[model samples]
Target: MEDEVVAEKTNRQVVEDEVAAEKTKRQALDSALRCLIQGQGGELPPNVAVGMNSLEGQSRKDGNT
Candidate 1:
């Protein structure tokens, strides 16, 4: 019936959304790892420096720092 078709479509959409979300997460992790590796020149990795800079920026924006 039409109801069954709609249900199937909804399920497919959910799966697609989950896959997209996972891809985004993986990309972020890969970016962070690359930054960290690049940051390894000093006491902290490059990624840590980038992360701290972002965190500081966010805190400033929120008026917390």
Candidate 2:
């Protein structure tokens, strides 16, 4: 039926949108990691920000985690 086709199309569009959003999020995270490394003289690895325990703890305490 026509309604079934429309529903399939809508579902596909939703999946494609989710994929695009995830790609965008990855790109943004990459850019932020690049900035962090460059600003710190490229001395640390990609996920160094995650290893910043003190700041992370502070943020959690402040409810900004």
Runs in model 1 deviating more than 4 A are 42-65
In Å, residue 28's CA in model 1 sits off its true spot by 0.2
Regions of candidate 2 where Cα sits further than 4 Å from its true position: 43-65
Q: After superposition, how far is residue 16 of candidate 1 from its true place, in Å?
A: 0.2
| Alpha-carbon local distance difference test for all models | 0.69, 0.67
- The predictions' CA RMSDs to the true structure, in order, are 8.4, 9.6
- TM-score per candidate: 0.62, 0.64
TM-score of 1: 0.62
TM-score of 2: 0.64
Q: Give per-residue CA lDDT, model 2, range 2-65, as digits (tens).
A: 9999999999999988866765675567568767878988655535655654444754564443
lDDT of 1 at 15: 95
Best by TM-score: 2
